[model samples]
Target: MKKYLPLIILLFAFIKTNAQYSGALPSYKLVSGNDWAKAKNYYLLTLLQQDAEAAKLLKADAGLAKLTADKIALLKSSLAECKDALCLPAKLKFTDDEINTVAERLAALCKPGSALDKLIKTHIIPSGTYFQFQTLAPAQLLEKAWRQDAAAINHTIAVYAEGAKPNYPQIDSISYNVKKRGYYTLMYDCSAEVNETVNARSLFFEPSLKGALTYLEVNERMQAGDYEPMATTVNKPAADKVKLTKWANYPYTHIVVPGAGPDDPNTPFSGEGMLRCKSAARAYFAGKAPFVVVSGGAVHPFKTKYNEAVEMKKYMIAKLHVPASVIIIEPHARHTTTNLRNDARIAFRYGISFSKPGLIVTDKYQNDFIMNMDKRCLQELGYLPYKLGKRLSDTELEFYPLVNSLQIDLDEPMDP
Candidate 1:
């Protein structure tokens, strides 16, 4: 009787040890056509904790705990909101992609010294391995495993979205004003032209002749009384014309031109011209207030347009009489949208207030586009103040003609 008792005791101890090694059995059997992926994570985590190494991995830190809880709550809410999509078992099937996604999320949550972290660091599991698990035909086992891990699945989605939200703060408001007579300018590419000039003499002579022709034509028409010199025609007038209304109150003006260098043939006016324009505009509005802004950035590898803002500002200050104190240069903007967004931000930061509308000066063709883009940007940035005004217009031949000539050179090469 004593010997049999010892045998029974030894057997009992062995059974207990085996049970502890396998971990607790999953709470339920895997259901067919049901999403068992999340449950599987629960089971794996439980099983992993059985070993000391796994146990270390399973210990959640405060950051992980808080994040996991928040994520779970969000997922629960999202799931409840999307009951129709989530409730269907068919929609829940564990695909390899889904499993990999969950795994990656889990890995991100794992702490550096944890057992789970070790596993991830050592294992090169492909993203879509969950679907392969289904091939084992252990549906009942998987369902049981997944059921236990339901909480973790919810947490993953919430955490991911939080991390992915746009980090840039949305602009709430932007305001700027000219304290005294000064100028602000916005320029854009309009059209382009090209004329051969052998030297400085030719460059000056040819444009002068063209200007003279334009002036003569205008004077002749005026003398004949063929047309009235209305403000709308002679200078941009206040009308429903989208361009004029856009800049009606924003009296500051700047010039945007194309080409690579300060003296690039594309923008014959050059950097000196930009500075002179700034100084002249500032002097004209003398007591009104003055602030100069230039917007443009470097061209991308595949982009055709050189950054006009940087080039324009550099030339405006270095070659022209414009003081650097009054000039704002935006060198990061790559497109019209960025130009409006970033430039407005700079203005807002500097405490520039706009009691009257602002001014925009660009090539004729770009007049409409810049005006509209500025309006849209202001609206987006939540800085809808006064309408912009068309402060000045340069001759089409000066900038537009040059841009047009370069399109063929700028287009990407076609595959033969």
Candidate 2:
């Protein structure tokens, strides 16, 4: 009981805060399949306390609880399972000519919007961010395992949807507005087995049924690259036309400079913010990058009328005598997470491929911390913020959209 105190308290707080809502799950067709998953999570969470009495109190359905016990043990072993299909197998010919051709071909095929890209993106590419999990499991054993996980996924999604139910005939769009407690539903561990061929389950989504099923088919296709007739290209939008010749102002890939908070009345330019801008300008002049992307909104201490990104760009122009044209200001990100997100949005808008990680320009400590932070920050922001439509760059040019994400929740749940 003591061990479960925090979760118990969190649940109660969640309930109390959301009491204004009807406290009823939405009546979507897929929501009906969520009960078992819900009960199993209750069982597993209670099971973790190691108190048989508390487990009994969860009152999770007998069947679900029993199944959950076995699944929980399996989860532990799954982590150490095979790491196959993660990368391409070794080459057949060591001769430079043959291997290089195959390598180049495979690399081209796996390009951002190639015919054979990573299978996970195929799932969400259909509906952008809104989706529900539907099982397309290959076998009975996997189906059973999936049921347990899906139930948990559905349970969390139901809570989130109920807490902030969208309007009827919900418009298809990405939303990260869900409450903090339901953050677990953001991504499902679709991998029923550790060695599951396609790991699309690791990607984040709204954690609903259709979304889950879309990725299931994607992962299933990963082991054997057989994309069932229309599995990967179902509802994805067409690629944005990119006039690459004139889009970029520079010849080489540039550095991303995410802005820190701005100063207030007493402090004209914050030490932290100035340091970030100065570092970015120094790198720009050092020939490390062709240009610099300075990103941030009017933030810090709130409502003071100082825009972080703009101020940084101004500082760079004044101190380094760097041409103003070399700096791009994204003036709407209020935090470090959005700094990356808005940068991606700006990149996509300008026909830039964010697939290549930029040299993040900031002080050493901030650089380390930003690099270490999980990419799930994208999930928390409710969209990829970069890749969505088909590849815009032409055949001669290669573009890879940023696709790395994690399973963590946000430090600040509300950003809008």
Candidate 3:
């Protein structure tokens, strides 16, 4: 009960923010989908925490260490004083010298025969192969990770701050809700008792991190072991089914249906969403593929209780009579980019062959949107999640999944 206390309170407290249109709080387990509790989705932080020698190197540099502490303190001060999201980033941005110094120290591990290099090769690189850290010199990788981590932290704070508009529609409401609670306002006073509870659950006060990084991690206590081993919970049957599947018999490995979330808060599934599922079900019945992969998260009209994939799977099974075994629910992707990326991850991990192309079944408008989204995918995800093959029809586009889609995205923390 003690360990569960934080989660219980957060579940009830944050749940209402959904009604008011704020986005869901970050869940680290869902973000990284691994047991990386300390670092969550930040690879550089994981490297340091796992290596005592590396942590010691940072701590031993009195100047850098002091600077780190000072920066953290400064962040706290700024949070107390900040009036808007725009000011937080300017206050927290890391200086070039600080980044270079830390990079130089950590890069020492990159020596060809060093233990750190070996760890990066055997552990880190495989953990996120899509990061393409292997292409970088050790120093370069360290610097890049450090800079990205710093920027990510700052970005989260800015998102949380009042008056900032996140690209994600509902997130702005979260910023508004937090401000209403007096979280970022100078005059809003919290009692010691309330402060203790806030430390356990608030984005600004997660127990595992201090200062701005706390904002980056979000709701750590509730997120602990949450949705971990996601493959086991969400897709274990599909994974098992894939083991016995005869891939050569099917023309395609899977039929993917990207979820269209309902815009109205009271609605469970959109008409477009139902149509998309119907389309995939039609393809499945046509013997187009052995499985239908539904991709989406609880993202629509700001933190609606409905999850797009979960609702779509229910519709498929109940209405369309699609077998439960053949419908794989990927209930994490928020955008169309992640819809493809996460489904590709499903394909790779669940024994679907990347060699065989998968067919995407969606409305003609969405199909056109997807085909022309190369620029958007590259801009947002830094790489394409799939290799486009051909246009089989207006409703179908042929695509081969890319392994790079497995890379964790820290930028989009909610669905990373």
What C-alpha lDDT values do all the predictions have? 0.32, 0.39, 0.64
lDDT of 2 by residue, 126-234 (tens): 2111212112211221223223343434333332322223221131111334335432233223334222432222211111233323232332211111111111121
TM-score of 2: 0.36
Ranking by TM-score: 3, 2, 1
**For each candidate, C-alpha RMSD in Å?**
31.3, 23.6, 12.3
Q: In model 3, what are the clashing residue pairs, if there are any?
A: none
Residue-pair clash count for candidate 3: 0
Q: Worst 10-residue stretch by lDDT in candidate 2?
A: 85-94
RMSD of 2: 23.6
Query: Per-residue CA lDDT of candidate 3, range 169-258, in tens?
Result: 563233245535345332122111122333211221121133234443332211322344656777677767888989888999999999
Query: Could you say which candidate leads in lDDT?
Result: 3
- Model 1 segments more than 4 A misplaced: 1-288, 300-307, 374-416
lDDT of 1: 0.32
lDDT tens per residue, model 1, 213-246: 2222221211111111211231112111322323
Off by over 4 Å in 3: 1-40, 50-64, 72-96, 170-173, 177-226
What TM-score does prediction 1 earn? Answer: 0.30
